[model samples]
Target chain A: MTTEVLTTTGAPLLQVRDLQVTFTTPRGRVRAVDSLAFTVEAGRTLGIVGESGSGKSVTSLAVMGLHRDAEVGGSIALAGQELTALSEKELSRLRGRKMAMIFQDPLSSLHPYYTVGEQIAEHYRVHFRSGRAAARRRAVDMLGEVGIPEPARRAGEYPHQFSGGMRQRAMIAMALACEPELLIADEPTTALDVTVQAQILELIARLQQERGLGVVMITHDLGVVARVAHEVLVMYGGRAAEQAPVDALFADPAHPYTRGLLDSLPRLDDSDDEPLRAIPGSPPSLREPAPGCAFAPRCAQAAAGTAQDRARCADVRPALEPYRSPDRLVACHFAGVPADAAGRTPANVPVPGPATVRPQGTDPDQEVSR
Target chain B: MTTLKPAAGPAPAPADGSAPPLVSVRDLTMTFPGKRSATGRRGAPVRAVDGISFDLAAGETLGLVGESGCGKSTTGRMLVRLLEPTSGSITFDGRDVTHLSQGALRPLRRHLQMVFQDPHSSLNPRQTVARIISDPLLVQGWAAGDARRRAAELMDLVGLIPEHIDRYPHEFSGGQAQRIGIARSLATSPRLVVADEPVSALDVSVQAQIVNLMERLRRELGLAYVFIAHDLSVVKRVSDRVAVMYLGRIVEIGDKKSLYEDPQHPYTRALLSAVPLPDPAAERRRERITLLGDPPSPAAPPPGCSFHPRCPKAQPLCKTERPALTVAAAGPATREVACHFPGD
Candidate 1:
């Protein structure tokens, strides 16, 4: 049966609120994503930045309704239509029609045996119920739109024959063949070289402007986000550590984790020989999270703070709320506190001893056992 | 930084007005046979590395930056003797080790080592951390007990707790595992370390930790590094001098500051422009030189200049004649660039 899809006036193209994804493993129930919320308007990009196991990919999968075995709880809306309440068939109809996704590696994503043109044509045929010749012609047009030279000749080649960059372009072409209004690209440029990455990003930007498509760009590289994203969301330990407009996030990061991430990156423009301020501890395990704030144990400010402030950090979980600016949100107990007032200690500052002692229970092995 | 005594050897005669470099490579080339074409005939050989030359001084870092398939990895592999070069001369510590057999190269192997890209696969999953870190010493015929002790020390040096030395590589995170790889590479106190994209696979925070540790190790132990990576920013932080490779050839080589601030070659400029700065203000304001197409295939590189097809400022001369690596007239003579039109 067709589901009633409502279109709200002035609503975002995609809206996610209080999203949580929990996976049932043999060991226990693991929380892959926790309370992730964001919105993407037409022709704008919202970048979800995080390291491995921070739930960025899981969030995307949950949005796409691809998490078959996981327990997904939250509100995900596309053009004001509630997606979590829809049936599998209804979701499938919307997946490649109203929304599309491209992954990190195009080699595995594209079919090896079929011709590139045939694959794109099939993608189009399934969605639009078009004739084979018409679908083929559309595929060729798409290939040319993506800047592939001699589209008709190249479309006959198999996935194996295409180069890495060309293969990615073909994937992009297939994704955009139906002209979806929303696109989710998970680490699309991670596998590509710098030059090719620039080209692919440029292509996606140009297409987004042309189609007015809402794009969700997922990557661990902050540089990528700075270049293309209008807004940024920083994820840590399966939660949004910080979220703000790209300019605000870079200029005045509220969360200590966000500050640490930015400070750690080696800048090409900076010629300083000083050592980088690396975040002290590894990421926490999702199976059993720490007591209060997930980042507290490794945060230098938390370590060096007054006893009362440190106790509050260890006992109370901070909610994602406005910090410094109305648009900026941070999940830290002392989000807007100045560095000196918060007792912030410089990272990588040499301890006056043989070797610095690691904070208790911060080790990955210890966390796994606990 | 404490000064460590140089390894004992007959110091070679001063070359080019200074002490001879610790490792010198000249005219290095590596070609791999390509697959057969549709006509059932073998295709041309892929020139993975083509006549590239460089020198690494003691305790210095020479960064090799390039995109995928640009022979940066191949060049790193050749330096550590992991792969045999089709043609080249590799001089190490005043001795030519280019043609040395495996048996003959054993003694000199202690002076050269490599840290691979993937920490997960580079390390043996089944082996204990101690065994993994001490493998070099064990190969060199060190006693098992001594090797274990040395491995413990190395763990401490790389910031891993000594108690976890008995754990497997699977027990550690990506960054920790990379540290184990670094510790293993330094087990024999090699004069030169070829790190192939060592930090690329790690998280940004963890990457800084590893970079700091490597920098500290370079000062403490006086180890030379040939840091190869695709990230220009990371390379700039750790390298004294940088080399830009494109289509199996070095397009530019100069001091890190000079090359980054005043890049001569168009390819080098394009590469620098392509890197997205973390600062949004600068990134938005930056004038990006978007290259048109992917780099030409290494196996069938374009005639004359391989980059001529994509170069924005390409001329007829670039399409007909390949430019040799030559010193630019305006800059320091040591700053060499392989471009017909050297400057903007």
Candidate 2:
């Protein structure tokens, strides 16, 4: 069973085992990713969802073998190849060839002077050992695949000439140009307006289906996760608080922190009456080694005799275990609610609607309950 | 010629038979001088804000929604004469203050205030909350003795402790610093406040708290607001009416529900469809209207309708003619759209 879980049809697309990423700054040593472990099966999407400072980016960076000033521990295997053992030059060779990443902001990731075609072709040349003319032709074809109209004309225009959405499409095109086995997208659509955001989501979805690629999407948004992710990993202060199938995680979150995050999100169809329940307190700073559970400071479930509970959460460090079914794994001390809990039925469970919708933008209605 | 008026203080026993809007912006147009490219030749002048017009009732909240570079922020700054408009007029209390000189606008500044996006950058680094809030009152020449009292009241109104007034801005959280900024904006008793992305920098929970306070203050003080933001969902929640802008033009303007539930303009519909729904079931069912390309450069917008290149309903006429802002066939006073084909 362990072998079957670890390897699918011989080798999993990407395997992360006790991956730890730490950064040393003037302030102190920050453990950005804390003993995190997860796997992304081929032709599937695994979402790592957390708020700012939750170490989502650090984890993805560690997977790409990209963090410069950080100490990395544990093993990341791609198609059974251990990436940590590879030399810098070897890793560089594998970067665009086997793995690719798309950043949140296209404007920052893309060079202003180069045309979209040139940048995509540059990545292709670095990996494929193809002729420049052949690379440019491939770049234009990839651009068309990402839904950019008039790829031929657009290939000649510089990055500055493209709008926010178009630039994002160009970024996706570059990532796909290499035909990598795995793709890492870090909030790739956060900076875009929703209309463009939806298009990008669809584009990624369609490409992933067509390519049979494993995708690791990192975002702070739960909504995006619900739409695209097949499996979910809920992280808090660098640790995976809970992991399960997308529907199962939302239907019945095992961890208190996961429960809190789910409650905080404003539902789109919410009626204008329910008062929003904001998660109390803030995420703890990770400047030093944590004493107990990192979520204890903000968690409401902690009690005086919780020192016993602390032993399990803080000292023991709960491992992921099957909760509902054999497939669903949750890493919480209290993996599932007791059978007699009052809020089990749909009538009692809070169905989020518009009234409790929390505003996510810079618009002024921040406080209006409606 | 209808004149705009500054939001008056509690009416003095009903002297005037009727009250007009606090700030009336009639066909306001703002054009900025764009720099020439490396070719040493001038490019088309950028219309940061084109002929856009709106009225701010004495105490109503008007939300301006658009993507970045759509000129909502420029429009906010122009309302208070921060950026001088090339044409049209902004009347404050029946006075045309659009082209008012800096010196002449200073006194009028007491009645209009702004809350900027970055609290840390907006607040003076060295100044304490007391000083920050008191600066506006002091600039209006309030006596030093009375300034502290008014500042304390403003701080308490925004839920900041009066005792912490002497603490510097760096000592506070993002939410706290924003409260300090809000305290300062209200210190002068400004009737109209232009808040540009006030809560975008804070956490979800903290954002809720700050937004709630703003709503409470709006009701209690009966102050008007020209709220500018990119988040349409939040705009729909708080605004009585929302105006959608694209390439320096108001593509659609309607009451919150109508604009959101039944957006007439194709651009407005596309914008609404972009917002991701939280529910797994609902999200899967919703048909998203995706725009194909990036918005055209505002500097050299498409010749006909600025949005024609990316607009889904664009026709031959749309490619050659700029559509005028007019009432939609749906015929709601709050529902006016500028489009060749306004689809609900």
Q: DockQ for each candidate?
A: 0.58, 0.29
- Model 1, residue pairs in steric clash: none
- For model 2, what is the C-alpha lDDT against the true structure? 0.78
Q: Tell me chain A's TM-score in each of the predictions.
A: 0.91, 0.86
DockQ for candidate 2 = 0.29
TM-score per candidate: 0.94, 0.87
Model 2 lDDT per residue over B270-304, tens place: 88777776556667898887887676667888888
Best by DockQ: 1
Give the C-alpha miss distance for residue B205 in model 1, angstroms: 1.4
**Top model by TM-score, which number?**
1
